[model samples]
Structures are given as structure tokens and as C-alpha cells.
Target: MYRYDNYDQTLVDERVTQFRDQMTRYLDGRLGEEEFRPLRLQNGLYIQKYAPMLRIAIPYGMLSSDQLRRLASIARRYDRGYGHFSTRQNLQLNWPAIETVPDILGELAEVQMHAIQTSGNCIRNTTSDQFAGIAADEVEDPRPWCELIRQWSTLHPEFAFLPRKFKIAVTGASSDRAAIQVHDIGLRLWRDDEGEVRVRVLAGGGLGRTPMIGDVVRDDLPWKHLLTYLEACVRVYNQFGRRDNKFKARIKILVKALGIEEFRRRVDAEWEHLKDGPQTLTPAAVEAAKTHFPEPERRPVSDEAIAAYEQQRQEDRALARFVTNNVTDHKVAGYKAVTLSLKRRELAPGDVTSDQMEAVADLAERFSFGEVRVTHEQNLVLSDVPVDQMVALWQALDELGMANPTVGTLNDIICCPGGDFCGLANAVSIPIAQALQERFEDLDFLYDLGPLDLNISGCMNACGHHHVGHIGILGVDKKGEEYYQVSLGGNSTDDASLGKILGPSFYREDVPDVIDKVLKVYVESRHADERFLDTYRRIGIKPFKERVYA
Candidate 1:
């Protein structure tokens, strides 16, 4: 993880002091709610349905054990005892008092963390693959690039007040685990034939009231010009993106209105003067960034240990299922990336208690390398767990209720805090997610269904990224009554696609049954060895829609 230097520390401390003053003024009636709105939003504080919600950024989803402990402390002291990990890979404190947010930010600053840029119409957190450095399929580690972007975008005067929020994701792996296609800017890192690093930049990808898969605006861009090129793209959007309507203010809308070719042309024209400017990256700078993320030391595991793991898998069904679902192959032979699922039966998706956070911190120190990663799927990853210690880690996680063997299953849902916490939500999303989890509690049945993504959002904001789920559920309001809309065939991958609506919205009580019918149709219609996504694509949405609406 990147440690903050004096400059970084001073910046965060100054911002905390500034916000503290702003908050005091607001409370003292020197500033009104309207005046304080932007000030509080810039600090990642939101006035929610019942209380204030504070979103703390976990840059590139990286967290040290110390940071995790600090977060746990903040959750316990400032708000309720639990916090929600969001789709953006940030943590949200749902019950923080408005007056106490500055104190919370002060604590976060002590741990080199902050709530800066986690919300409002500015460049938000820069995210990347959870297994960025450890993934077997990675061509390069995207964290350095993510870090550079984070530094560049944080409080950038040019982009501080964009028409709408901007999100950027980077992926070094061939697999699009970071959902690059659905970000305002998606950087895909790859090497040229001559081994020079390059980026393929995608623009306009976003999910909201209008969902879109980004278009490649620039391909094979030299790594040195990454920042300058990004600046050009954002500049184009800032100048032309609509401000009259919040719905159409996003860069995605601008890209759509102008067409990819024209958008590219405009960005290219903008980049002409800025290509090799002060912000352009250099080899020395890249190397300096890389120094902060040195590779972890590799430890050899004997063949006997591997044999024991295989033997355990053969003997214990539960262990086998856990390995199959929660564990991923690491680039290193002896290590594995283990996902600590936050989704349990009764809890909302991505909700982790303070005690659980502390437990994970301890487990990270004991099993992994004192590091944890928050995934876009609302799970945590211990990216360097040794294979020899897998069984012990599994037991520890199980005891902590974090070892759910439902990763990539329907039960591993990605959901937003919905009407329960978010004032913008039209209906409650957590109950729907819980109901679906209960309806699909059978492990055998879930495994049979195979690799399904079920995501829910309380509204069209797509905070839950429901647009990209295999089964997307969006809460809707019809004549003051809450209803749910269902969509199928959506996926966030190399072949990203927005789901199509099945039909009119269904009542809240009908959602679980509707999903069951859809799955039944899929199971009956799928060919041998076909995954849920493949089956849906092969047969089209008609079969599922017919059964769901029947």
C-alpha cells in the first residue's frame, strides 16, 4: 500500500481543519443548509434518510491492517457498530451524526485515510482490480496508474465541480473484474509488440438512469501521456456536457450525443497542447510509484502441503465448496486470493460489523501479508494467503461468519443501502436482497445454477450496479406504491452488456417468485455445461421473460 508522505498528511489535515470550521459555522447558523451542502459533500458527508452517511475512500481498494482497525474504531465510536462496503469499494457509515463527521475525519486522517472525493459531482475514488498485483492473468499491475490518477483527480481545480460525478477504473487483467466498461473512464493496460506499456482508453461507460458500455476513444496510447490524455478527455466533457439537467450531465451523455469519432477528435485536439506538459508521466516518476508497491516475498510450499490440500478437498465437502467458490488462483504457485464474503443470510450485502472488521484485520496479519482489498463485488480479498494455511484461514473466517461459500453465486448479491439509508432511494433494496438470499439458500441448488450475479439498486442511480448483473433488480415507484423492475442478460465483463427489462414492474412480494421463475426457465433451457449468462444469451430473454411474467 502507498504510505502518505508529509505533503499528503498536511493536505488531509488542512482539509479536515477546513471542514471542521465549515461544519461549526453551519451548526452555529452562520451558514445555511443550502450553503453547507457542497461543503459537506466535498468532504463525503451526506444527509441521508434518517441520519448522515459518511463515505470513506479506500483508494484502489487497498487497506492495511492498521487502516482497517482505524475504520472499525470509527464505525464503533462515531456511528452504529457496522458499516456498509459499497460497490465503489468505499465504506459508508450509515448513522454518523452530522456534527461529529469532522471528528471522524480527524480519526481517519490519523490512519492516512479520508472521506475526500467519495461523493458529490467530482471525480470519485479511482478503483482497480481487487487482485491487481496478484492475479495470474495480469499483464501489469494497475495500482500504480490508479494511484497516479487518485493524486491527479483529488481536488483538481479544473474538475472539482463537474456537471456530474466521474468514476474511473483500471484493469491490468484480461478478465474485466474491475468492470472497466461501466466507468466514466476505463483504462486497460497492455504491452505493445515491442514490450512498451500502453493504455486503451474507453470513454462514456456508465450505469444510471441511462446505462451505456463505453466506447474506445483512444487505443494504444503511450503510458507516458496517460494523465495528459485523461485531462483532455475530461476537459472535453466539462466544456460540452449538459448542466441544465442532472440526468444528462455525465460524460457518458456527452460522448453519446457527440458520437465516438467526434468525441475522439475533440479530445485529440485538446491533447495537442497538453500531451507532453508538466502532468505527463515520466519513467522516473513511474518507477518511483512502483517502488511504493514492491512485490511481496514469496515462500515455497512443499508438495506434501499441496497433497494435503487436495486430500482435504476430496474428504471434506464443505472445505471443497469453500475452495471452489471463495478461493482464486494467484500468480504465485504457493499463494491464493481468498474472498471473505460479507454476505450472510440475514445481513445486507456488503455490511460488515466493527468486530468483524477487527477480526479480518487480525486474520490479514496472521494469514495474508497484513493487507486486505475491497472488491467491486462488495467482498474483501486476502490476496496473498499461502496455500498451506488455507484450511486454518477458512476455519477462522467461518468462525467470524465471513466464510460463506457463495462467491459468484446468486446468494453473493451486490446491493445498495436503498431506502433504508439513502434518501434518493425509491424503495428498500436490502429486504429484496435478503429475500432472494433466503429463497436461494440451498448450496447444491446454487452450485447447479452456476456463476450468477444478482444485483439490486433502490433507484436508477445504479449505485448497486444493477445494470450489469446477470439478474438486475431496480426498485421503482408507481403511483406512490413501491414496485421492482427486473432485467436479464446483463453482464459486466470483457463482453459487457446492459440487461433488458423483462416487463412491467412487479410488486415487492412478487420479486422473489419472479426470480425463481426466471431461474427455472434457465435451468430447463440450458444446454450441457452452459453457465447462466451463456444460457440466457443463447436462448434470449424471451423464455425467461415469458416464465417470469406468466
Candidate 2:
């Protein structure tokens, strides 16, 4: 929704030109693979298993219909006719040719999107709640703060190459939908008793070989100092974060090594000089950032219209299930936010075809004010659909195969493009996800299970956020043989917690059966109205582990 100005346009246009030349040099042997590695990474190009993967930033997961359509066009013209929405809310074209990436970048620039700061040990995308201003429980819209951070972090000279990739997430809602607890820097926005905005800052949280819930470093920081305080946090990490080993280079590792007290002390000391300096936010600047995210025009619905919506949903069980699963309450009266399920059993999670993208763009324009929001859960959301048009929208989405009515169900899995596309993956992840989805295709079984998060990662990089899923499956390689390790009781919420390993790894063929056993244990042990997560947390992992390993 934030249109590029002259400065933004010039910056992107120039970067495209520079990358094009750099790519030409690499092809002509003027630059070797090692020499061109950083350059390519800085532009969000990764040499994957089969081809180059280009990750285009969708800042804070906001996309205009025009931008979405452009992405569809680019996917069709440059790569395969589909793209994967990553957990970071970025889109990855896994089959883009290395040489043609510049052309793809050029097309993205035309739509005010780019691959900048999307990869390579720098401050990556600053994500926020998908339902930001539209959420009923929001204290403040975090998008403005997210936008401010995006502008600050993008191409930042100070943090261009941190020890490892850095991720920051902001959330305005009481619910932790953004998973701030698992980010390098997590900001929770709220208002003080006097109505002044404040932030609860969390640091050193990540998942991989080591998983952690970010510690609360700054409990009550003023919103005006958000940028400057962040500067201090990253500056500390940039200076002291591990560099000797890539695996140990995340801020979480550093935080664990130094302890939270010392990390906070060092950050406070750094902020002493940077505070009230050029980076400190002002009222005018904050207001300017807010301008980019004006609320959608809202219309009051009549009581009769509300009644009609309720009547339709009540009369049709299918419509009611879809509504209960895919629709969320909006802050505005008679409006709702609808999630377009990308987790259909027919396709991999988060993989949207070019045609699907175009269709979503059209639907967003027709129902959601020409804009879409990408959720970190790998779903697309129309954040402002009127209640009066719910039935029509549901019918259209169901027809388009975007309405599986499994928003928070077991089949709505979070998965990575594992060995199929990722060179780092030790084993395939998509197939495991597919197997689970197919096994749990019964909506009655899924709804009975209730709000299960089944996440899979090909390896420990945890791109799938598997560490926080109610049930986590991580791919492991034992002497070149593919095996899957299972973890349970993980949760990414207000009370975030990392999962515990159940036992030793299982062969790929046994993964589905193992999961079925875990679910069976849960269903048998759970009390009335208890979720899988609550049941696991209550009864501990022993029951599921026993069932799974038995």
C-alpha cells in the first residue's frame, strides 16, 4: 500500500542497473562464483539445487493488487508459473535463471517491490501482524512502525553484513500473531496509562540448532525511541555477535553466551550516544509514516444486513464452517478479514500459481479495497471484506480452490521448500507436509483435533517456524539417509515456548503413522474443549512420546 516516491524509485532503478551489470560480469567470467556470491545474495538471489531462487520483499506483508498482479506476470515470464510465500511473508521464485534475475528485479521495481535486504546476514524484512489496523484488539497499528523500520534497515550501511541473518518482527495486537518472541528483535506495541505509545522489546530469540524465546530486554520503551533503541540493539549485535562460525552467529547465540543482563547493559550504553541523535523518531516523522497506511473507507451496515449474513451462514453448514475457520473479526462494524487458504491438499503449502495470484488480485480489488495482506502462516488475507458480501466472496473463493476451510487446522501446515528446491535442506519437507494433509483431509477429524499447528522444516534453519508449531517435524540426515525428527508442545503465542524432541528420528515412511499416533494420544488424553497444545502442555510430552515411539 506504500507507493514509492521519487527517491525510492531512483534507488530501486539504480540498484537494478547495478545488478544487471554485476550479473553480466559474472556470466562473462570477469567475476568468479565466490566473488559474485555476496553481490548476488545482497540482491536476494540464491543459487539453489536446480536454479536460482529470487526472494522479493513484500514489506510487512502488504501488497497492492497491482503489485500482486505484477508478481504473477513476473512468475509467468521469468520462472515457473508459480511462487512460494515464505514464512517471512516474502515471495520466492525458485526456478528463476541466474542470468534473468536482473530482468525480474526490473519488473519488481516497476511495481515498487524489490529483493533488497531480503537475504545475506543483513537486517531482513521487518514483519508485523497481518491484520494490523483491522484487528479488534490492536493497541496501535504497527505497520507505521514496521514501515519506519523498513526504511531505516533497508541498505543500512551499519548493518549491511551482520554476523548472520537478522529478523525483526512487530506486533500491535494482544495476540502474538507475528511471532515476535522468535525474532532477533521483537517489538510489542501498546499504550501507557496516559495513552502514550510504548513498546516491549524482546531480543535473542531464534530457532535452528538452538531454539529460544526472545528475552524481554526493554519492558517499556517509548515509541519515539523505537528506531534509536533498535539501532543500539543491532549495533551491539553487529559488534559482538559471532562471526567465527555461521551456525553460531545469530543474535540468540550471542545473547545466550553473554547473558541478558550484560546484553541489556551494553545496549543501554550504546543507546546513550545514539539516543536523541539523527535516528530518534519525532512526531512529524511518525505521522508521515502513518500516512502510508490510512484506514480503508468503512461503511456502516444496517441491522438487516447483519441479520441476513447470520441467516445465510446458519442455514448452510458449509458456509458456517468456512466462516468459522477462515473469517476473523474486524475492528470496524459489519466488516471481516478473510484468509485465502493456501494449504489445500492438492498443492504444497504457500505455493500460489500465477493464475491463483491473478485471481486473488482481482478478488482483493473486488472485495478488500484493492489490497492483500500475506500472513506469516503462509496465507493471503483480504483484510476488509464487508459482511454483506461474505457469502459471495466465500462462494467465489471456494470455486477458486482457495477455500479449504482449514485456517488453523492440522492440514493448514507451515512447510518449507525443502530438498526439492533448497540446497541447504538435508531432506524433502513438502512430501511430509503433503502426507499429513492427505491423512488429515477429514474436516471432522481436524475440527475435533482443534487448532493444531503442524510445521515442517527440511533442516534446522527453521524456515518453516517448526520450533513453534504445536507439532514440529524437522528433517534430519543420518549417514545420507533421510529421517524426520518430531517435537511437541511448541507454541508461538503470547506465552511462546519451544517444542521438546519426542525421541530419535524416524524413517520418512513412518512419519505419517507417527503423527497419527501422537494425535491419537492427544485425542484420548485431552479434556473437554482442550487444544492439542493445551493438552500437551498439561499432560506433558511423555504420553505423545510413548505413543509415537511405542
**Considering every candidate listed, which one attains the maximal lDDT?**
1
What are the runs in model 1 whose C-alpha is more than 4 Å off?
Answer: none
Count of backbone clashes, every candidate in sequence: 0, 0
Candidate 1, RMSD to the unseen true structure:
0.8
Give the clash count for model 2.
0
lDDT of 2 by residue, 121-149 (tens): 89999998999989999999999899999
Residue 538's lDDT in candidate 1 = 91
Q: Show the colliding residue pairs in model 2.
A: none
- Give candidate 2 regions above 4 Å deviation: none
Q: After superposition, how far is residue 224 of candidate 1 from its true place, in Å?
A: 0.1
Q: Write the per-residue lDDT of candidate 1 for residues 431-457, one digit (tens) a residue.
A: 999898888999999999999999999
Query: Where does candidate 1 clash, by residue pair?
Result: none
Q: Superposing all C-alpha atoms, what RMSD in Å does each candidate have to the true structure? A: 0.8, 0.8
Query: What is the alpha-carbon lDDT for the whole of candidate 1?
Result: 0.93
